[model samples]
Target chain A: MNSAETALFGLPWWQAFVGGICTIAIFSFLYKENPFYRFFEHLYIGIATGIGVMATINTFLWPTVLKPMVGADRIPFPDGTYAEPYNEFYLLYLIPIAFGSLYYFILSRKHNWLAQLVIGFTLGYGGGLAFKATFNEMLPQLEDSFRPLYVAQQGAQSGIDWLATLSNLVFLFTLLTALSYFFFTFRRSEGGPAEKSALAGRWMMMGCFGAFFGATIMARMALLVERLEFLINKWFPLFFA
Target chain B: MDSSARQKDSLAERLERIDRRVVYLLIALALSLPIIFGWKLPPAEMETADSFFRVVDELQPQQGKIVLIASDWGPGTQAENKPQTMIAMEHLMRKRIPFALISITPYAAPFLESMPRDIKEKLEAETPGETWNYGTDWINFGYRPGLIIMIQGLAKASDLHEVLKTDVSGTPLADLSIMDGVHTIRDISMLMEFTGLVSAFNYWVQFFQADGYRPPFVHGCTSITIPEAYIYYVSKQIVGLYEGVAGAAWYETLLTKKYPGRESGTALKINTSLAVAHVVIIALMILGNIGFLVRRGDS
Candidate 1:
């Protein structure tokens, strides 16, 4: 569908107008802090918050929880048998519902401890899961870290893959040095192997940070380019096209 | 030397403390002029994005198998993720592979509709009569609640039809022709996730691996998280990576090479703009440094 058909959001041209205005209002902050930027910023926050709440409830909670409990999801035959059986187990959703409701108790002055009960339960559950998740995510990286120093490709006699070996060696060096840099509790003398390793690690980390910072600038520039593109291609066309 | 000559309003002094607004204007003009005049050229393809394109392009539709796309970004990172989503989605469509869109972020809900429609329009414009209609071509699973919980639920679900029940529009998944043969995570041919959030990406790696059967995973990450995302790519956890808009631009370059004469995507244009802006920034930085050195020597 074209912008002409995306009128579900608003009139094709009207949406652009509103968007252009909002974009300019938000961009006004580059000059100085002003009511234009402030108003649009708050408007965006309000709209986003409202959308988040409604979408969470309508798309997730209503279908996942309430419909199951209310049998709104079930298709009943004339004889009162559901095509999809409504398991009484659906009522078990209420336990979580009740448990999650304790979060509202945080607003209460005296009964704030009630909120902590669920908070503790959630934290404990999440903490236990994080242990497994961290391991799940880390183990592969650890395994990949252990590469063959000499990879013999085509045939073992053909000769070791120097490029692969060099890459692996570089990886190992980076891994060890980066790891050593975090060994803050360890004591090392000046110009010692450990100290040198840590320094190398710092340099490598700085290089990585530099790449990250460059990427960040690129990302921000991309964003600016987009707003400018919209102003030129989409917004300007609204008036001139 | 006289005090008057010492306190001269020279070019070095102007370079040393140029107003930030002027810098912004210069940067904006550097970015905008090329776009206005159309010097936008496709960037050199990166090996990583080529790997990404090859992975998606190599996907052949099979019975009980389809791509699962996580359009897990919002307007905030639209500059990068939007093009990434488009390039990936366009490839999937070009290959005629059925796919489903899911997101853990509520903000991604609109993207689930708009991105596909954007692609559909583009495809239709290029090739008449080959329209990408919803329900048959793609299905929006919409925003699922908790990331870990949602991913884990998808992993454990024995029957996805029963689990998903309906698409974002409240249409039953069973009714959608695209949902045919798509039953479990096993049927997911490839899992492609595009997002700006590293934590969300982490959850996919952490929880999306169902029954030890992780379908070839690919990631399109925002520039901020590209450094971290590489770990997954290098670890062989994700088979491919789109590093940012740069990655997407490179992938688009590859696609344009494959299918010449099609209207080029905005990734290349935006990327070119970024290149020009980088040049302007570098020049400014050089001038500023020169000014600093000159002032120090004078002192």
Candidate 2:
């Protein structure tokens, strides 16, 4: 094996095995609670946090900060390509990073004001963003929902067919009834029409929930199967070999 | 008999219904046997899958400066995301598409390292003449912690090379040949995100589209996430979407169809497991209902 492969395997065997074992151990917490699982759980988070901070600095802050200010236009490469001329706007990100760090200052009465500048800008951007995206996403869906219960393809009797219309009508009812079920203020109104509609709405909502639940369970099962494959196919087979 | 003995008897009966371990064993058998035998199922194309393929196919790889791949999943989700990552990279490779990867999650770094290398080696071994080079053809930006802020930074920044200085290899991004034509998010012709979380895609749609710059966006997301993710597909927020292993298998089918003799057994194996799991789960649900009805009748 080359140095790279050696380097990968060079990590203490115990450490590698423990790391792999710890993953399964932590997963076993889903079945029951134990200290071993909890210990690894905290360790994983702590290690991940440290690594994350290091990567952020190495990948973002350093190149975006120290390299541009101090390091020259040429840095060594595997292919020996020189660094391009530095741009200044990269440094402006430091302001947000600095402001974001002040969130920890909430404990102190004096330095806490610094946090709001960051929070306020975030809130403002988030609000503007939500307003814009909400319209962009929802408006189109709303427009598409008004389809005339059937579609027609060229030179075909496919347009406004009964089955197509029936399905579309069912879809429309499900959509509206599910929406109406969430109407809390009109719950007390007991007209025959309203009550009948509300009961239908409740059943429609249940169907929606069931479909949602089934889809969710399937997805979770897929994820589980994926993990099991990795453990058996990638990890265990190698270990045995 | 005492009340407690009666309770114990009832609990034992419930336990005797069927050993849960037996269920686990059945699931294991279902997933493993087909995979071991290299079984391939017939493709059942979904519109979302079709749309995903169409978007990827339509990208003018040579014209597009760089394909931006958001690899936001970690090893915990390697089961699904690994194949998704491989298939995407393979597609990009076949098209001579030079791509750069960015990760918004912390756990993504290790998987990012392993995934590209695995694909590169596989491409080399399977098609010797079709050598896919690393550091030149493809680059990984590794993992950045602040997802929303980092993506926004990328969106606004005019020069990504100058902004995020280094590739995943620790080579300066400026030094990499792949960054030559790419500068901003706008310069990207296509963006493909393979994520374990639905919210990451939601974040992409919200933040990226809010800036009034929407590229032909495609997603490879987890199966559980597809329903919510499909809503975006319906709304046209994303151009196309792939759902979990089935999605990965569908993508694999497309890839092998376009570029024959590529190493693609992975997707098929995963999909077989899925089909069996579906059958097993349906059976369990029916049995569970039967048990409930039988108990009600007895009472």
Candidate 3:
């Protein structure tokens, strides 16, 4: 094993101590909600918020907006004379900034119309994007929904391909029935075909929900496992291992 | 009551009234024991991970073809996304493939900044003679504000250098050897997005792929997003996907298969821990249901 690997396993004693304490504090919620956990939780939130603000300002605003406006170089004219280093046209960036600032006007009773202008514009723009997004994103998936019912000889050369055909058939059935379940325009009697199909659709939806819930549990467990690993392998190793 | 009858009564009633703390402690123990004991498991290879690996494996390094890594995950998803990113980075570094990392989310910048360092150390340790330089091999474009707008800008920009003047470290894009032929979205060989949000995946598809400049797109998403992601996968929108930790474990197994002696990293360990934790949870559920049935019978 390399020195780096050893160092990774053998974290400094103090670091391990702090990590262990924090891990315990977070895990203390399992026993009951306590002050230590609450304190650490608040600290985490404060640090996260602070980092977010600084990252936004430093990484996004400073580079894209501030620097471009304040640090533009002057272009030489035909007469060999130079204008101001920063371009005067860059001042136009303030227009959007001014508009964005109008959102703060929402606090006022009389001038809340100014805030609505920004809100309206944002909604209009977002809605347009959403319209475009719905087309581009969903349309292709809609097209792909057209799966072949029968397998071609060349396509089903392998057993796996035949299984794929069966899977596609199942998919098509599920899709149709699920759509039927959502079709609430017409009411159907207990023994009607539509009612039966809708019932199947409900079952299919439940299966999908079950899969989703299982995935969610797995994801959460993965996170918990990671934290536990850190505490056990990385943190406890300093003293115990 | 007889002793056997009393025992039967207690078994049903006790399980029904089991403390939440006991369950929590069991879960905690189940997760921690595997790690503490250094238990390991062989991860099964999946078609999804194989598809993802095949794309990266086929790429020729040092050919001016670059992968754009759209990192849209934060600390909340580090357990899943971080390992995915690390594995991808390790593959790229080993192959000497030049790539650019960019983030649209606010919290992703700092998290991604630490990646290159980790990759560098791993590469140096694994391959002693091989070298990977920052500007020449990879570049970090920190964080951008707009998701859709940024994707649109990438697609529409005539000169990517002009659009993105400096990288995360305030270095000029023109100075980076990695950006030699990478000028626009069309120049990108492929895109691998590791995101926690389904909306980000949709935006990537809407702006980058469906907007005409279609690169081979791969997605690594949280397990919660996998159900939604399968729709895109079936639609052939995303060429490959890694569905959280299980997917990551599969990829690691593939990596180990491709290059022997590669350490089975956190993914495998976490997968085993998760397996045990899941069993405990399932047992708890089953017991709870049994208790419910018994209580109902008594009523």
Q: What number of clashing residue pairs does each candidate have, in the order they appear?
A: 0, 1, 0
User: What TM-score does chain A reach in every model?
Assistant: 0.87, 0.75, 0.83
Q: What are the per-residue Cα lDDT tens digits for candidate 2 across B223-254?
A: 66766777778767688877777877887787
lDDT accuracy of residue B62 in candidate 2: 58
Using Cα atoms, each model's DockQ against the true complex is 0.74, 0.43, 0.70
Please, what are the lDDT tens digits per residue for candidate 1 over residues B1-104? 67765665365688889899999999999999978987776586687898888888888977668899987888899999999998999888888898999998
Which is the leading candidate under lDDT? Answer: 1
Give the per-residue lDDT digits (tens) of candidate 2, residues A16-120. 566568768876766578998898889988987898788778765665556565545355578866556556665676776677888877777998887777778
Collision pairs in model 3: none
Which window of ten consecutive residues has the lowest lDDT sum in model 3 chain A?
A: A152-161
Which structure is stronger by TM-score: 1 or 2? Answer: 1
**Candidate 2, after superposition: displacement of residue B83 in Å?**
1.3
Best by TM-score: 1
The better-scoring model by DockQ among 1 and 3 is 1
| Per-residue C-alpha lDDT of model 3 across residues A1-241, encoded as one tens digit per residue | 9886677655575677787788789888878899999999998899789987888898878778887787543445789775656567778999999999999999999999999999999999999988988888889899998888776556436434677688898998899899999988887888999999999999999999999999999888887887887787767667655
Residue B98's lDDT in candidate 2: 85
What is candidate 2's TM-score for chain A? 0.75
Interface RMSD of each: 1.0, 2.6, 1.1
Indicate the worst ten consecutive residues by lDDT in candidate 1 chain B: B3-12
